[model samples]
Target: MRSETREASKNVLGSPLRACCHNPQTGYFRDGYCRASEGDMGRHIVCAEMTDDFLAFTKSQGNDLSTPNPDYNFPGLRAGDRWCLCARRWQEAWKHNRAPKVVLEACHESTLEIIPLSVLKQFAIQAMN
Candidate 1:
C-alpha cells in the first residue's frame, strides 16, 4: 500500500486505532478517518455505537440518519453500528440522557476540544483497545 493509505489508518491523534466503522459510512471526508477540517462545521469526531434511542433522538432533532438517502449515497444506519457523530449533537444527546456508547480510541482527538475526557468516559465503550 501507499504511504497515504497506511497513514489514514491512524486516528486524528496519530494513533493506530481501528476505524470506527464504514458499513453506513463515516469520517468527515468519507474515508473512514473520522477526520475534521475547517470546512467541517459539525466537527464529527465522536465514534459512537448506534442505538434505537439515539437514532430517535437525532431524528427528532431533524437529522434523520437512519433513513436512506440514495441521492447522497447514504445507506442509513441501524442499531449496533458505529458512526462518526458531531460533537455537539452527541453532547446534546448526553444532556438529554440519550447518549450512546463511545469508542475512545476510534474517536477523533478533536472531540477533546469540545467535551472533556471525564464526560466522555461516562459513556465510553470500555474494553476497546
Candidate 2:
C-alpha cells in the first residue's frame, strides 16, 4: 500500500517538480547537485495544510499587521488587504531557518520577476508541513 501510494503521488507531483527541478540558466539542480533530469532532486516537497500554522505563528510573534504597531515594517502596505503582510514576514523567517535547495533556486529565479506575497505565503504554508 505504501508503495502504491508513493507511486500515485509520484504520478501526480512528479512532472512540475521535475521541470522546475533544475535551474535553467545554470543547468544544475536548484540544490547545486548535478544529476540527470530523471533523478529525484526532491525540489517540490511542500504541504498545503501549514498555512494556518504560519498565520498563527506570525500573529503570535506580534507581526500581524492587522494589529496596530505591527512588528515588521510594511512601507507601502494599506488597510483591507486580504493578504497579511505578517505572513510574508513569516516566509522571510522560514527562509532563514534552513536553506532548502529548491527554495534557494526559486529565490535565485525570483529576482528576475516579482513573486507575489500571496503565492509565497501559499508556498510557505505548504512547505512547513
Candidate 3:
C-alpha cells in the first residue's frame, strides 16, 4: 500500500528536484535533492522519523522544538512540526559540510529520479568540517 502511494505520488509530482552545490575553491560538485511541497504548495509529502542523532543535532544547534513552526515560505511547514528522518538527516548533512554556502540551481526533476548518495556523502563531509 505504501509503495503504491509512493508510486502514485511520483507520478503526480513529476519527479524530485535536483540541485548542485559547487565549492568555488576546488570546483567540487555537491549534488542533492531539493525538498518540495506537494499539492498547491500547502502540503509536504515527505515523511521522516525522528532519531536520536537528529535530536542531539537539533539540540546542539539550539533549535527549540517547542517553538512554532518556522516560516519556511512554503505552505505547510508550521512551527513545531517535526521533520522526518530524511529531512532531519538532510539538514544535519548540510550543516556538517559548512560548504560556505549551498547553491541550488534547478535541474530537471526527472534527472533527480534517484537520490544521489554520492552527493549526500559529499554534503556530509562538508558538514563535518
Candidate 4:
C-alpha cells in the first residue's frame, strides 16, 4: 500500500528526484523517474548504472535483466544504461561486491530505507570521479 501521506518525490540528497533514464523508460511506472507507490512491491527506486557483472549477477539470481522481454516491452539492459533498480536488489549486489554505480540525484529517497546513505555514497557515480 501507499504511505499515508505521499512524500514529495525527492532523491537521497533530499533534492528533487531526477529522471533515471528515458531511453528504456525505466521506473515502476515506466515514467523514467525512480519512484514507488502502492502496488510497487519491488520498490524499483534505485537509479543504478548497469554493468556486465551486475547483469550477470542478477541473471544468475533468476532475474535476467539483460535479455529483452517482448511481452513486457523491455529492451534489455547493458553496461552503461541507467535503470531504476530495486533497493534491496542493489543492497544484495553490494554485499556480493557486484553492485553497479548509483546516480544519487536520480535515486529516490525511499531507497535510503533499504540502503544507507553512507553505503550508497560508497557506490555513487559522482564519488568515483
User: Candidate 3, residues 63-92: lDDT per residue as tens digits?
Assistant: 533334447322232322233223333444
- Write model 2 residue lDDT over 17-97, tens digit each, in one string: 212222121112233221223233322222112234444555576644234332433222122122312223434546655
lDDT of each: 0.78, 0.29, 0.29, 0.87
Write model 4 residue lDDT over 9-124, tens digit each, in one string: 88999987888888989988888888877678999989999999999999999899999999999999999999999899899999999999999988888888889999989988
Best by lDDT: 4
Best by TM-score: 4
Count of residue pairs whose backbone atoms collide, per candidate: 0, 1, 12, 0
Give the residue spans of candidate 1 off by over 4 A. Answer: 1-17, 126-129
TM-score between model 3 and native? 0.28
TM-score of every model versus the real structure: 0.84, 0.22, 0.28, 0.91
TM-score order of candidates, best first? 4, 1, 3, 2
TM-score of 1: 0.84
| Candidate 2 global CA lDDT score | 0.29
**Positional deviation of 96 in candidate 4, in angstroms?**
0.5
Error of 4 at 18 (Å): 0.4
